[model samples]
Structures are given as C-alpha cells and as structure tokens.
Target: MLTPTGEIVAEARRLGVGAGAFNVITVEHAEAVVSGAEAAGCAVILQISENAVRFHHGRLAPIAAAARAVAELSTVAVGLHLDHVESDELFDQAAANGFGSAMYDASKLEYADNVAATACAVARGHAAGLWVESELGEVGGKDGAHKPGVRTNPAEAAAFVQSTGVDALAVAVGSSHAMTNRDARLDHELIELLHDAVSVPLVLHGSSGVPDDELRAAVRGGLVKINIGTALNIAFTGAIRAAIAQDVTVVDPRKYLRTARHDMAETVTKALRVLTGATP
Candidate 1:
C-alpha cells in the first residue's frame, strides 16, 4: 500500500526500529525496493535524488509517476521521497509529482543561510502535504571530499530541526556518501545524544558505507531512518557483470537486468532486516 513517509517513520519510531530508504534511479530500482520491502514485511521509502533528476534531463514526473505506480502495486507500505534537493524548482516539482516527502539539502550554505532556506522549504513542503527532511551539515564524500572526521553537533542539529520545523533530520555521524567500501564507523554515542536532543527522528545519510553490525548498532542506539544507495548500485552492477560473464552471447537487456534487479532486491531485503531486526 502507498503510505506517507511521516507515517512510515512514525511507525518505525513506535517500534524502536529504523526505516530503510533506498534510492531509485530507474523503474527497476523502484520495483526491486518494493519487492524487498514485501519480502521483509516492513515499510520502505523509495527516494529519487537531484542528480537522478538531472540524469533524466531535469524531469521528475516520469520517474516519480513510475514510483507511485510501484507503490500502488506493492503489498507492503511504500513511500516516495525526493532526496538531496537543493533547488526550490526541483523541490516544487517533486511535491507536484506526488512525492510524499522530500529532503531540502542546503548544507553547503552557511549555517544561518541553511536554516533560512530549509525553513522556507519546510513551509512549502508542508503546504503541499509533504513531510520535510533536511540536513544540518555536509555528511562527506560529496564530489570526492571524504572527511570522515566531520560530525554533526547535537546542539546545532536539534536547533536546526526546531528552527526549520522539519519532520526528520539527517545528521553527519562519521559516515561518508558515495562510499564503495562498507566499513564506515558511526559514532554511536553521538547518535544517542542527537536522538535525545532532537524532537524529530534521526536520519542517517551515507548509510551504505556503514557495515551491517555498525548499522544495527546505530539503529539500536537511536537512528531511525537509514538512507542507502551506493550499496544497492554495487549489488546491481555486480549482478549484471556476472550475468554477462556467464552468457557472452546474450544481447537481451532484460536477461541481465533481471539478474540485477533480483540482486538489488536481495540487498534491500538484507538492509531492511538489519534496520528493523526482522527475522530472516
């Protein structure tokens, strides 16, 4: 069933578990995520990033509509979210295109500027009946700048959430984005502190970098929303490579794409199990 992002997150919070949000760049990605959520019997969030929109020539409606269709067909609850949207135009487009939630990322700006921009975005999102999410600081690994030492200050994070009136807060806690290696270490103590100080559920961006045990510990410590992208892409591409290697004469895209989708689904299922502590 199609569910609102706020409702899904609220449920996860009530259950003391983390909700997995997977990035979907294509229809196959959305389908795989829904399949994984159904397999795990847990709610899932499907996210479309700004870069993905750009990849489609700044068009969001097509992909967003596809995701909505997938959600409608899904037996398990699913939410569509716009991720890392830095522009008002794209944010408005996402809301107009049926995204139930969006992340307005202005972390590159100065602190006060970020707050002001995010606050405006929050008001707009709420007016459109969308749950808003925003990041306080850069999480790292953006454009090849890997600053693993950077972390979000609990005080600043709480203040940002309060001032912006965002429904969720994504924080920097020693995890870097675009990480191919799943060995990132999260600051469990900071996660607990942020959870205690902030009114909204804590969102961990760059979660694909964090290992399974650390991800489990992060969720147990207080993180509620886990956003993953790179890991799924890795699994998907690996499957495609393996499929081609096994059948050198295969020219049909569906043959290899089927394997990719299935592999990606398995990865998402594992992530959901780790986040929700579901029995496999």
Candidate 2:
C-alpha cells in the first residue's frame, strides 16, 4: 500500500523499530526493495537520490511514477522518498512528481544559510503535504568532517528541528557517506542523547557503512529511518560480475541483470530484518 513517510516512520518509532530506506537507482532496484519489504512484512522507504536524477539526465518524473505505481501495487506499505536533494527546484520537482518525502541537503552551506534554505524547503514541502527532512551543520562524507571533529549536538539538533519544522532529522553520529566497507563507528551515546533531546524520529544517513551489529545497536539507541545505498549496490554489482565471468560470451543483458536483482533482493531482505529487529 502507498503511504506517507510520516505514517510509516511514525509506526516504526512507536513500535521501537527502525525503518530501512533503500536508494533505488533503477527499476530493478525498486523491485528488489519492494520484494524485500513484503518478505519481512514491513514498511520500507524507496529513495531516489540527486545523483540518480543526474544519471537519468535531470528527469525524475518517470522514475517517480514507476515507484508510486509499485508502492500502490505492493502488499506492504511503501513510501517514495527523495534523498540528498540539494536544490530547491529539484525538491519542488520531486514533490510535484509525487514523492511522499524529501531530504534537503543544505549541509554544505554556511550554518545560517543551511538553516534558512532548509527552513524554506520545509515550508514548501509541508505546503504540498509532503514530509521534509534536513540535516544540521553538515554530516561530512569523504569531504572531510564538518568542523573537523564535530557530531550532532542534542540541543542544536532539537533547535534545528524545532526551527525548521522538519518531519525527520538526519544526524552525523559517526557514519560517512559512500563507504564501501561496513566498518564505520557510530557514537552510540550521542545517538541516545539526541533521541532524548528531539521529539522527531532520527534518521541515520550513510548507514551502509555501519556493521550489522552496530546498525542493530543504533536502532536500539534511537535511529528510526536508516538510509542504505552502497551495500545493495555491492550485491547487485557482485552478481553481475560473477554472471559475466561464468559466461563471458553471454551478451544478453536480461540474463545477467535478472541474477543481479535476485542477489540484491536477498541482501536487502537481510538488512530489513536487522532493521526490524527480526532474526537474520
């Protein structure tokens, strides 16, 4: 069933569980995520990122439509989410095309600018009846730590959420974006403190880097919406590589991609279970 992000994440929060938000780059990615969601009988968020939009040549309507269709047809509730969108126009574009929620990344800008831009985006999203999520200071990825060794301050996080009126907050506890290895260490104490200070559900970006045990602990600590990307990509690409290596002359795209999608589905299903506190 198709539902709003607020409804989906709220349930996870109420049940003391975490909701997995997977970044879908292709139709196969969407199918894999939906398949995983049904296997777990859990609600999942399908996110289309800015990089994906760029890869699709600045068009999200087609992909967004397909995702919405999948959500409606799926047995489990699913939310269409726009992830790491940095531009106001793109945010509006996604909301117009039918995204249930969007994360406006103004973390690169100055603190005041980040707050203002995020606040404006939040207003626009709320006006369109869509959920908005934003980050405070900048959760630095490979671009070097924001402010050289800073994590999200509980008071500051609460202030940011209160000021912007965002439905969710993505904080930099310790994980970095685009990490291929699941070895990033998270500040569990900060996660709990932020949870105590803020009223909204916390979001953990770049969750693909955190190990399975640490991820489960993060949810136990406070994280509600967890964003995973590279991990699934690894599964997809790994299968693709193996398929081609096994049959070098296999020129048919469908054969290799079909196997890849199945592999991705299996990995995603495992991740979803960990997020939902079910045995893997």
Candidate 3:
C-alpha cells in the first residue's frame, strides 16, 4: 500500500481535503501512524525530520529501512517524507533512503538565498521523482527571524512556487511550532487567497498548534498537506509519563512503550478523522 506522496496531495487538493503528514522518530511511531491511518481508512505520509536524524546521531539508514518495512506492511496507503531538511547531503539522500517526498527548509536563510537553495533542492528532488515542498516564509519559531508575526504574501508565494518549480509550498498563516496548546488562529482569508494564487498545492506547517475546528476550516480554505509533529510527541510522552507513574516497579521498557504507542495511535486516528472528516 505504498503510495506516492504527490498523488495523495493532489487528490486531497482536488477534493479540498487535508492530507495528514505525521512525523515519526521511532519505528514504533511508524507502526502507530499506520495503525491510526488504517483505523481512519485514509492515506497518510510518514515524515522523518532533520532533527530526528540528529537525534539518531546522524544515522538514517536503519530507521528509514524500518519505516519502509512498516509502510510495506501497512493496510492503508502510506508514503515517506523528509521534513525540515536543512542539509544538502541529507536531502540528497532522501530518495535513496526511501522517502517519497521531502520539505527543503531554507526559511532561515535570506530571501534570495532561500529561493536559490530551495530552487536547487526542487530540481534535485524532482529528478529523484520526489515531491518537493518548500517554505516561502516560516510558519513559526521563537526566533526573531521566523516568529508568529511572519506571514507569506500571496503574490510572493505564487511567484516563489513558479520560480522554484516546487511541488508544494508551505505558507505562514498563523500557526506556531511546538505549541502545547491548540489555540493558533489561522487567517482563513489568506489561506484561500494563497490557494487561489499559488499554482501548486498549499501546505500548513506547525499544525499541532491549530485547533480541530480551525483545521477543518483550513482544509476548506485550500490547505492540502498539513504537517503535524508536536501533537504526536505530546501524546507519546504523556502516555509514557502516565504509564511509568502507574507502575513504578515496571522495569521492562516495553511495558511503558506499549502504552505510549497505543496513545499515539489514538491521537493519529483522531487527527486523521479531523482532517478527512471521517466518522468516529
């Protein structure tokens, strides 16, 4: 059931639906995501971030192989994606490492530099048959360079997409990254304008901070690909905390990890339902 990431995004765009992309740090996370997608009966993208690569001490082959295996065994359609890829070497390795799509993040660089770097990434990704995603302006960060106030201009976004030849563009509307609270307010009007203006599919990053109602509204406003990471980490960590606390005598790692995995799966299932408007 391995599907192309572009197919999922394009179909979602045509239907005005959200194509959920969940980040996976561990093989268990991949399994949980697949389980959740199957429960919701929808296709999903499993993302591996640059930060995650660093977490694994710069090793990607093992985890990437595991994710590919999980995707092959999945009942629901699944695709692998690379998120927030800052390094050229890492981005270049994505296709060979089993990723169907990748987001090249040059948002930290100067505008011209970002365009140049992202354009280069787009060409390489396209050559590898990978769906290329890039950000015009960052969606969120505590840093001054990419804060909550940053918003992508519709015209500029359109131009960027056209110039870079990217498959999709992540626009800054209102969401902030790593928000523990789901209270981010998105500009529905801007989202619609961006969608109409841009030639490619629109992406909403830092979606974990967005509320469910707003999420559905974003889809209605033409957000096709939604990147969600912090929410899964929140669920995974919260469950681990609860499980370990309930049984202090538990020495087995699997005992607590099992609880965490199940909770994360439930969270993913809910998110998929919200994005796809699936029945509970």
The best candidate by lDDT is: 1
* Residue pairs of candidate 1 with colliding backbone atoms: none
Which residues of candidate 2, in runs, are more than 4 Å off? Answer: 142-149
Task: List, residue by residue over 138-164, the lDDT tens digit for candidate 2.
Answer: 565645645434588899888888888
- The C-alpha lDDT values of all candidates are 0.91, 0.88, 0.89
TM-score of each predicted structure versus truth: 0.97, 0.96, 0.97
Q: In model 3, which runs have C-alpha deviations exceeding 4 angstroms?
A: 142-145
Q: lDDT score, residue 109, model 2?
A: 83
Which stretches of model 1 miss by more than 4 angstroms? 145-147
- What TM-score quantifies how close candidate 2 is to the native fold? 0.96
- Candidate 1 or 2, higher TM-score? 1
Model 3, span 182-262: residue lDDT tens? 989999999989988999998888899999999999999889899888899999999888988888898998998888889
Model 1 poorest ten-residue lDDT run: 142-151
Residues 1-280, candidate 1: write the lDDT tens digits.
8889999999999999999999999899999999988898889999999999999888898999999999999999899999999889999877678889999999888899999999999998999999999998679988854355778999998888879999999998889888999889888999899989999998999989899999989999889999999988998999999999998999999999998999999999999999988877
Show the lowest summed lDDT stretch of 10 residues, model 2: 140-149
* Candidate 3: C-alpha RMSD after superposition: 1.1
Q: Relative to the unseen true structure, what is the C-alpha lDDT of residue 127 in candidate 1, on a scale of 0 to 100?
A: 93
